[model samples]
Target: MDKPTISKNPTKKVASADHKNLSSIAQYLKDAQGSHKRSIPPLDQWQPKHCGTIDLKVLANGEWWHEGQLIKRQAMIDLFATVLWKEDDTFYLKTPVEQIEIEVEDEPLFVNQVDQIDIEGKTYLQLKSTTQDLIIVDAEHPIFMRPFKDELRPYVHVRFGINAVIQRAAFLHLVEMGELSENAQGETVLSLKSGDLDLHLGT
Candidate 1:
């Protein structure tokens, strides 16, 4: 199989000719964070023009790449992850002023760590992504089983309509925390509970 590659010299043009390169975009994103508190831009309100495609891509293994080069810095990855947006079925790196399309081989994120915590008297599952994005398993961020290759795999909702495929180890941990029982149809079901939210892992 041939490996995907992008030009080392990426020169994609955008509506704003002044902001022509990824470096400017990166700087803008960094500057946008005026305070220490971490938060995403109100992308819902901003109607930035669609900037042309970029060489950035998120591989199936949850690795980020730019111009065919692997992005090894976690801080850079986390910064880019914050701007990931999905429209219809395509994924893009969105900014307050512009958006650029990017390739995603599979799910854009991965949940590699999970912990069980008790809030008051209710139990909750806390999931951490590779980028350090924390998500709580509940009514909004639910887990579902999806077919991957020949086997069923677990996936959880992250944010902004994006989701993460639960890693094997974390999936095993969830199974250990779940309760197995026969459902109304007499099918074996594995379930987990968090606060008032009850979820079925699989059957």
Candidate 2:
């Protein structure tokens, strides 16, 4: 498949249009420093604030770019992922003091690794994201697939209202683990069950 074309100026241009919000978030991030070991911040309690958007974007392949430049620091991406928050229709990287809107080409996160574990006849799928977050496929983190022309793209809920797109490698692994089964109307389908949730891949 051809690589998706990207425009790096869009995000920064948006932020430039609204200097108030843009500067606020940028200043907060520049000054804020601490270990990101804690869980996701309590975003629901944060009152709506207008922090301008950033040039930061989460690409389709799970790459984070800033100002049209690739953010090569995995540590930086992981740190930013911890603070991802969504309010209404906007996605943000929020800290206690400020919040900055970010552009996401697809889902906010990308699942790059997957492992299957079987115990006592039950199978569990463990997914690892680009940010190194571990997510288990269960009722809480159900999988959904959307069609992209002839290809179907899969996504899974990561946390705090953020969803991670399952990349090609991990998706193929899931397909390898899929088992053929007959669904409710006796229609044969390829399905995979993790925890208590059963997902239909395809025929």
**TM-score for each prediction?**
0.85, 0.75
In each prediction, how many residue pairs overlap at the backbone (N, C-alpha, C within less than 3 A)? 0, 2
Segments in model 1 whose C-alpha atoms lie over 4 Å from true places:
6-21, 181-188
* Cα lDDT tens digits for candidate 1, 1-203: 55665333356553345554566777788898675455677777778888877777788778887766787878778777888898988788898878887888778889999898888888899999887888988889999988877777789998788889898998888888889888788887788887788887554
lDDT for model 2, please.
0.72
lDDT of 2 by residue, 1-203 (tens): 54333344544534454443434444454455444353455666666555666667777767777766677867667767777887676688777755667877767888989998775678889899878888888888987877755776888887777888888888888878887777788875668889677888643
lDDT of each: 0.80, 0.72
Superposed model 2: Cα runs more than 4 Å off = 1-33, 36-38, 118-122, 148-150, 180-188
Task: Name the candidate that leads on TM-score.
Answer: 1
Residue 76 miss distance in model 1 (angstroms): 0.4
> RMSD in Å for candidate 1, one decimal?
3.7
Candidate 1 lDDT score at position 91: 86
